[model samples]
Target: MISFEAVAISMQGRTLVRDISLSVMAGEKVVLRGRSGSGKSTLLKAVVGGTPITAGAIRVGSLAVVPENIQRIRQEIAYISQEPGMSRETAAEDLLLPFTFKAHSGKEPTAAQIEAVLDRLLLDPAILRQKSATLSGGEKQRLVIARAILLDKRIFLADEITSALDAESKDAVFSFLLESDHTVLSISHDPEWIGRCSRVFTIENGILREEK
Candidate 1:
């Protein structure tokens, strides 16, 4: 679960969003939409300690999103950016790279686990053999999603995750996200994806409101 209590974000004498009090329950899939630069990204960033909130606070599960809890909060949340920066000699290694880290050691996914998630996301297993740089935008997006799924994150904070995907790929991505077992708060402009979310929110003039 995630909670924002009277949150306000300001940068360089300008306020992006203010008075944001929201509670996303466990297992809820919420989508937020706004014009570019309306601070939707900033809101998600705050959840992972990327951006600082001038007022109020945010909580992930029982942990507060402070310096002391940032690392732990990050472990519980998968913060997927709009365009994930991919850098692996091959797509196969890309999936295996995180496991090399000390923190993620012993968490490497097995072949069966990898194959299952790839199929669920409609990705061809052959793509794993291709050069990571050669994969299309949609493929990269799906690969990133696959990585998150393999990690078994409990919460998701996705930012314009499917912006580069085509209709068919977008449908597949939506299916995986909505059907998965995670608390999700995504930012997207796509009407179809927004309609599938349990709730929709929009921010304007530094205020956040539900799109009832």
Candidate 2:
């Protein structure tokens, strides 16, 4: 449900991505793999309008990723970065914060739903009571995923979200996402994550090349 056409991104006069074009269909999972500076993350950010494309176009569903529609477009997409930002509140409060927004009012996840997501991610339900600052890196990552799940956004832009987890936790996170019907475009170096995806693309010198 996402398409990029002849997309190029530059910042501060430095070109980060060039002439990249691709489409991610609904319910399909795609992975982007590359070295540190290869622009995979930048491409993901561009899809969410976090980084503006200097050339060409991007569209989510039927809406173009332009200034006017960006805010609405973002509501349909969950862009999870390598380090998810969290407030100093308890985990439960952080998770519930989104529902307080007018956009998601009355859509708060029930306690059972929250517990179920935590269980699937191998997290303890009690974690909801702990302060976000006290959670470990992996805990924070899983919690971020849980929040996204609660939002029920169908499009996911995940950037190295599994980097901090151990094997079991990593598998748990991967399995949950894989089993879901979300349209995922992710940046990851994890072999298992890449292997489970339906398509893989690698970025080289700012160009996107689909890997066979």
Candidate 3:
């Protein structure tokens, strides 16, 4: 449901991704792998308009990633970065913050729903009471994932989301994503994560190439 047509991304006058084109079908899981600075993350960011592309076009579903439709595009996708940002409020409060917005009004997940999501991610419900600023990196990542789950977006852009998790927690995160119907385009160095994807691509010298 996402397509990048001959896209090029540049920052500070230097091109990070050049002439990259690919398509991800609905319910498909794709992984991008490369060494640091290979533009894997930049390509993911481009899809969500986190980074601007200097050339070509990006489309999510039937909508183009342009200034006018960005907000609408964002509504349909969840972009999770490597270091998910969290507020200083309690974890539960932060998790519920999105519901406070008019875009998500009246869709607040019930307490049981919240608890079930936390349980599915192998996170304790007690974590809800903890200060977000004090949580570890892995906890913060999972919390971000929980927020996305609550948002219930069907497309996910995940960047190294499981890098900080323990094996059990990583598996928990993986299982949840694997079982979901979401279309995922992720950047991961984790072998297990890459292995589960139906398609894999590697960024090399600013170009994207599919790997079997």
Candidate 4:
């Protein structure tokens, strides 16, 4: 679950958003929609402590998103972006490379598990051996998602993840994130994606409003 109470994001004297309050319960699929520069991305980034909130608080599950808890919160959330950064020289097989870091050393996924996610995402397991620089944008996005699922994280913060995907790939991603065990908070303007979510919130003129 994610909670934002009276959250405000202000930068360089230009207020991005203010007095925002929202709660996404466990096992729920929610999406945030807004016009360009409406602060939807800012609010989503705050949930993972990537952006600082000027007022109120943001919490993930049982932990507050503070300096002390940021690391733990990040470990629990898979923040997928429109263009996830990947090393040009690395092979796709090294998708789980982050697990090599001290903090995630013991969390690497098994070979069989990696194969399963690849199948579920409709990706060719053989692509795992391809150089990261050679993969298309859609391919990279899917691999990023596969890595997150293999990490066993329950919460997903997706920012226009389907932008580069084809219709079929988009559906695969939608189903993967909307599964019963996962909780999703996505930033998307796609109507199909919006329709698939259980609830919708739109940011307008620096305020957050629910579609209800």
Which residue pairs collide in model 2, if any? none
Clashing pairs in 4: none
Give the better candidate number (1 or 2) by TM-score. 1
Clashes of each: 0, 0, 0, 0
**Each model's TM-score?**
0.96, 0.94, 0.94, 0.95
**How big is the RMSD of model 4?**
1.4
Collision pairs in model 3? none
- Worst window of 10 by summed lDDT in candidate 2: 164-173
Q: Let me know the TM-score candidate 1 reaches against the reference structure.
A: 0.96
Number of residue pairs clashing in candidate 3, backbone atoms closer than 3 angstroms, sequence gap of 3 or more or interchain: 0
Model 4: runs farther than 4 Å from truth? Answer: none
Error of 4 at 205 (Å): 0.9
Overall local distance difference test of candidate 4:
0.86
RMSD per model, one decimal: 1.2, 1.5, 1.4, 1.4
Error of 1 at 56 (Å): 0.1
Candidate 4 structure quality by residue, lDDT tens digits, 1-212: 89998999998888999999989999899999999989988888999888888889888988999999988898888888887788746655458777888977897778899889999999988988888888877788888888887787889999998788877777788778876579999999888888889999989999889998
Order of candidates by TM-score, top first? Answer: 1, 4, 3, 2
Residue 203, candidate 3: alpha-carbon lDDT:
93
Q: Weakest 10 consecutive residues, lDDT, candidate 1?
A: 77-86
User: Which runs of model 1 end up more than 4 angstroms from their true locations?
Assistant: none
